[model samples]
Target: MTTDTIITARGLTKTFTVRKAVVEAVTDLDLDVQRGELVAFLGPNGAGKSTSLRMLTTLLPPTSGTATVVGHDIARDPAGVRRRIGYIGQGTSAGHNQRVRDELLSQGAFYGMGRRAAATRADELLESLDLAPLATRKVLGLSGGQKRRLDIALGLIHSPELLFLDEPSTGLDPQSRANLWQHILDLRREHGTTIFVTTHFLEEADLFAERVLVMDHGRMIADDTAGNLKTTLAGDVITLGFASEADARAAAARAGGTAAGSSLSLTVDHGELVLPRLLRELDSVTSATLRQPTLDDVFLALTGRSLREDAATSKEEINA
Candidate 1:
């Protein structure tokens, strides 16, 4: 492994049996994550985002394949991997009965810190995550967002080099979610922490992560910078409105575009390069517009389904 590589996996696979039916949660996943990089893993439910994370964090052993996390083999040295990484799962990991500061100190103790060192670390995390005021409050008395912050502080007590966050903002209100993101970004900037996060919020992933990985049906479908994926896979959509339906059809045929009513639409790799030529070639063109693609459009183009819709439907199916 390279010195800069924080995570390396080869053909990582996991399977489960539910009601005598075989289910492949993750299949043949190969991944590499470098130091100090923030990456987002995005997919609908049952897309293996959590399964893959569990394997890398050593919470769930992979059925096949192998991986090394933070320079330690996941199978052979789970303790070493655990020591070097912090994991905040979907549910809050803080103890309900303990005081916020006590819980943080306990986490530090688990990592084998001296009492004074643990207390110092706990105070630092409490201040950093905006939990200093609530340090003396019982964990059970805190609000949802406060509890979530405590969970993050617990994870960071050891100051691991890498942090794995599984849906950290899932249950937060809009303002709280925004606050959490700011803290996460600040952690990366100040501590040079490598963040590997999985979130259902497409917009957050698009806006925050340096790189995005899209998984579907237990397989990784796309991996690239969000801007590159949108531009390369989905492209820019150019629409031209003609004077009449017949004119639109004629112009579409000449331009090799799709015709609808009085409009002709074509997706081009570079809309600016093609727009002027299209205007000159199509005499009946009245109005022309070019639209940039979003990460949602990229997902739709790759999987033939909207990720937002898939996520909602999957949730409903599970509840039913």
Candidate 2:
């Protein structure tokens, strides 16, 4: 492991027995997450994401190998790991009968905080999470957005060193989801708590993570900044269309130096990645379109399939 790594797994393996057959969920996997980094753990459903998280958080034991969370061995120091990490599963936090504020305060007090300190911290977090107006409301009466926010406040009440969020904003409305994302940014900026989260939203993974790790079949396939992933994916394509077939053909030939696609009524002759002097050729052309490279392109290039497809296939394998 590197000097700054806070989460380390070496030769990690996990297996489960179902019926009369043994299945391997994770095999000889090595993972390292740096301190103070918000790492996104993503994959198709049943890609051992929840299982891996459970092992790290001490909810389940690994079949073999070692993992250390926050510098504490998961096997030897389960309590230490628990004390250092706050986990929010893919579920709601509120009890139907409890008040939001009361729930938060109780969470704080459970961690040995005094009543006064717990109450103060709870109120502060309630306001910070935009739950102040709903602080006194019954959990059952709160909106989905409000309840999720309260769940976050509860997760943070103890000032944990790390937070594990599994699809924290899965069912939130767009506005609520945006609010939650901003809050996550603020949490990292203000408290420096290292976070590990999982999500199916590719856009979220693209935008939020400083560095993202993509996984398939419980194995990591790629890890890098989103831009870098896109830049080296494929060759560029330029298309030119015109009003009339002849105009289209002329424009296409002028830009592409050949014919264009069938849908392209105009007549670009050839469609190769590298055409002759593109600028010089297109300088005289007026009607044309260019497809800039993007992360999706990179994802497809790297995975040999679309991200959505990879996710679905992974889900099937996991289920099988």
TM-score of 1: 0.92
- Compare the candidates by lDDT and give the number of the best one: 1
10 residues in a row with least lDDT, candidate 2:
262-271
Per-residue CA lDDT of model 2 for 1-320, tens digit only, reads 13388889997778888786887776666888887888876566666677777788898888998999998999999988888888887778778899988898888877878999999899899889988988888999888888889888988998887898878888898899989999988998887888888876777877788776666556667777665655555435565544456655655554444554431422222324433445355444445565655445556776676767766665443332
Show where candidate 1 strays beyond 4 Å: 1-3, 253-255, 272-288, 316-320
Number of clashing residue pairs, candidate 1: 0
TM-scores for every candidate against the unseen true structure = 0.92, 0.82
